[model samples]
Target: MSSVRLLIGTRKGAFILTSDGTRKHWDVSGPQFAGWELYHLKGSPADPNRLYASQTSSWFGQVIQRSDDGGKTWNPPGTKPEDLMGPDGMPKGESNMFLYDTSAETGKPLTTHQHYDGTQRPWEFKRVWHLEPSMTDPDTVYAGVEDAALFRSTDGGKTWRELAGLRSAKGHLWQPGAGGMCLHTVMLDPGNSQRIFVAISAAGVFRTDDGGRTWRPVNRGLKSQYELPDPDADVGHCVHRIAMHPSRPNVLFMQKHWDVMRSDDGGESWHEVSGNLPTDFGFPIAVHAHQPETVYVVPIKSDSEHFPPDGKLRVYRSKTGGHEWEALTKGLPQRDCYVNVLRDAMAVDSLDPCGLYFGTTGGQVYASADGGDSWAPIVRDLPAVLSVEVQTLP
Candidate 1:
């Protein structure tokens, strides 16, 4: 029988949950790097057993760990890659490296951010918000980081080098959102290896046509009153998350700071699909693995108050893409449930009668074995849940 593994990343550590196809009783194993923040954990699609995790800390900075036998064991890549740069352009002289092009087109070092005091601060590598493994190669993976840059690890997460073109494309226009300019969502087009989509909070959406070499802002129709002075500005919209079904790669769905949107023409343009959703101010948007038109979003009350509407935990599903929605609340709490779901907390597995999974800030991970008809908590009472990824094992 086939089985499933839920790779859960939390504020404190990482956990692994396993179950058979039934997905009823589960075996939970972890708190893996106890006391460290595991921002994201994802398995390579080409090799299910190979996994990568983004581990970070205030004192230790960032570390990338890999596991070959699922989550049973983990180790830093055997070779030590040099550090790219410190918080500033100065060298930290540490190992486990990140390499970004030092010299800019103008013969000056890259300037990534501006501080509150109006000082120009060089881009600092904070943490990896998302990790995307190549669909065809297990050893190739991509990392999206804070201070807004993209890095790739070709040796199975052992080493990384920034795709510096993304920083050069519109680096000056990119400003930090309240969340500090993190690239939280990375999507790969399975049909076109050259196409990639990424969402950065307070920076809108960007797409690369020729892989990661060059990128352009794709916020044509997005309107943000809170962050952008001009409603139709080139960039500077707070896009919470974006999702796409593998079968229909061009069609995209977005969960913005205040609205749910859809892009039909490969993100060259977009339109609001908020529909009848009570409040589209939520994080995390996902698509059913088998049903391309079916989508899911968890609607929170507002940006200031990151809780479900009316204290009701509901997973809104749209069977016709968007413009219409139905609430799924069979087993969820209806009152006093103020937990918020992070942008990377929701995921769907490619199983028959597809399974949906999401983690909450309240330290609970919920699962719906039969899509969103009904649901149950797989585990509860850990650190705040940051991300949830699922792998189907043959």
Candidate 2:
């Protein structure tokens, strides 16, 4: 029988949950790095045992950690991931290994981007918000970082080079949202290796057709009346999260800061599908594993308050893509529940019936063995859940 592994990254540390196909009982492991901020953990589709993690701290900065035997072990790739700045000359002379710097690559200072207050600020490196392992190569991976920049490590996580071309696509226009202008979503197209899509908070989504060499803003038909002077600006839309099925890469679903959207022609354009939803204000959005038309989202009260609407924790499902939605509350809290779900905190597994999983700000991780029809909690208490990734093991 096939089993699944859940890689849970939280505000404090990381945990791994393993379960057989039934997904009823689970074997939970670790607060892995103890006190580190594990922003994201992703397993390589090409190699199930190979995993990558983003470990960060305000005082120590960001470090890329890797594990070859799944989550059993971890190590920073090129250098000692400590905050020691000395002439000892670290592996890459980077006292903080992952700081956003273009001196080595471009011999220029970091590009400045538009700030929320209409001021320009130099891009800064804070943390890796997401890690995307290549669909075909276990040794290749991509990292999306704060102050918004993209990097790729072909030699596993040992050495990384910035794919600075991403900046050419309206980098100066990109502004930080409430989430700090981080590139939080990295989607790799399985059909065309050259095509990759990424979403940045408040900066909208960008696509690269010729790999990482160049990119273009694909935010047409997306309106942000209160956020931008032009309701349909090419950039500067606060896109919370975007999801799509591997089988249908062109079809896309998005959870915006205030609306749920859909795109049938990739990211070339998008349209609002927030119909029938109590409130389209939410963070995470996901698609069913087997049914491309089935979509899920958790609607919050509003941006000011991140909790669910009416204090009822419900996962809304749209069987006909968008516009039409149904609330799934079989075993959920229907009242006095104020938990919010983050963009990277939801995921789905490739199983017979399709298992859906999501983590909450209240430290609750819920799971549904049969799509979004019903749900149960895998674990109730933990650090604030940051991300949840599922891998189907053979």
Predicted model with the maximum lDDT: 2
lDDT of 1 at 306: 91
Tens digit of per-residue lDDT, candidate 2, span 242-344: 9999999999999999989999999998999999999999999999999999999999999999999888999999999999999999989899999989999
Over 4 Å off in model 2, which ranges? 79-96, 99-110
* lDDT (C-alpha, whole model) for all candidates: 0.87, 0.89
Best by TM-score: 2
Q: After TM-score superposition, what is the CA distance of residue 197 in candidate 2 from its true location, in Å?
A: 0.2
TM-score of 2: 0.94
Residues 1-394 of candidate 1 have per-residue lDDT tens digits of 8899999999999999999999999999998999999999999999898899999998888888888898888877643335345568675433256655676652135566544444556877778889999999999999999978788878777667787777765666677777788989899999999999988877789999998887888999999876567888888788999999998899999999999999998899999999999998999999999999999999999988999988999999999999899999988888999999999999998889899999999999999999999999998787999999999999
Q: Could you tell me every candidate's TM-score relative to the true structure?
A: 0.94, 0.94
Error of 1 at 342 (Å): 0.3
Q: Report the number of backbone clashes for model 1.
A: 0
122, model 2: CA deviation in Å? 1.2
- As for candidate 1, its clashing pairs are none
lDDT for 236 (candidate 1): 75
lDDT of 2 at 102: 66
